[model samples]
Target chain A: MRVLVQEALFDAGAELNAFAKGDTDIGAVVSFTGVTRDVSGGLSRMLIEHYPGMTERALTQICEEAQTRWSLADVLVIHRFGTMEPGDNIMMVATASRHRADAFAAAEFLMDYLKSRAPFWKKEITADGSEWVAAKDSDEDALDRWS
Target chain B: MIDVLYFAWVRERIGIPKEKLETTATTVMDLVEELRAREERYALAFSDLSALRVAVDQDLSDFDAPLSGAREVAFFPPMTGG
Candidate 1:
């Protein structure tokens, strides 16, 4: 299991290949990459803010919860914070297991939890002004499927 | 005394990221009340509790949570992380 919270741009392809390499026993791997999207108002940038200590702790706990709930061999999570262009990558999660079902379910679970549980906040800086991204009720409701 | 932190728009509104506060309030809500009474900025930031979330000692918590020995408390809008 590996967790990284950084401000630097990372190559998602490299990370994916690195995670999928070796591990002879693993039969399945699932990954999700989140990217910054442009707002209808023309996004100039997206500023991500997070709690240094708490972000790491909360992500670790969420990953552990995923492991507990699924039969998985490994998990990787990388999240970035700082100023980013609309096309920039925001974060990624990968889960490996002996079964595709387990890997897919766990990856989705991680994404759902990360959307609301993580401390990071995104502010959309558009042509006119900047506004904080609001949490969606749908994101919170997505948790119901797991329980 | 405890350290109070704000993030995102809450920080923007309050004009500071964090501060050391002297408070006798026991619960998170009480502390929020004290902060709201401090000035208009705080009140405006905390105008709607439903749109906000709290954390005590870096752990997500409720407003009714007690601050018996907590060293830190954070207030922010609902997280929009992915």
Candidate 2:
């Protein structure tokens, strides 16, 4: 398991390749990448703020929970902070397991927890001004499916 | 002294990222009340507890959580991470 909280951009494809390499026991690998989206037409950029120590701890706990619930071979979570423009990759989650079901389920579980549980907040900057992105009720509801 | 940290708009409103403060509060809510009484900025920042979340010792916790032996506390809005 690897959890990375960084400001530097990462290549999703490269990370996936590296994650899948030398894993003979795993028969399936699933990856998800979250990209900064221009919700408004005038989106200039996004500023992601995170609690330095807690962000890592929360993400690791989420990943560990996923591993415990699923028979995962490996898990990789990389989340970016600081400034980013639309279309930039904000984060990625990769899960490897002996079967596709476990990999897919663990990946989704990780995403759902990361969305609400992680200590990162995003503020969208646009031509109008900057506003912090509100946590959606739907995102919170998404966790119910897992529980 | 316990380290108090704020993030996002809370930090913007509080005008600082973190601070070391001595307090006699035993719970997170009590500490918040103490901070709110300190300045108008803190009062405004903490005016709506529904819009805020708390962490005690870097773990997500409740406003009523006990602060015994806690070294750090943080306040922020609900997370919107992915």
In candidate 1, residue B43 scores what lDDT? 95
- After aligning candidate 1 to the native by TM-score, how far in Å is the CA of A53 from where it should be? 0.6
Tens-place lDDT digits, model 1, residues B1-82: 8999999999999999999999999999999999999999999999999989999999999999999999999998889888
Per-prediction TM-score:
0.98, 0.98
The lDDT of each candidate is 0.94, 0.97
Q: Which ten residues in a row have the lowest lDDT in candidate 1 chain B?
A: B73-82
lDDT of 2 by residue, A1-147 (tens): 999999999999999999967979999999999999998889999999999999999999999999899999999999999999999999999999999999999999999999999999999999888999999999999999998
> lDDT tens string, model 1, A46-144?
999999999999999999999999999999999999999988999999999999999999999999999999999999888788889889999999999
What value does DockQ give for candidate 1?
A: 0.92
CAPRI category for model 2: high
Q: Candidate 1: misplaced stretches above 4 Å?
A: none
**Candidate RMSDs in order:** 1.0, 0.7
Clash pairs, candidate 1, are none
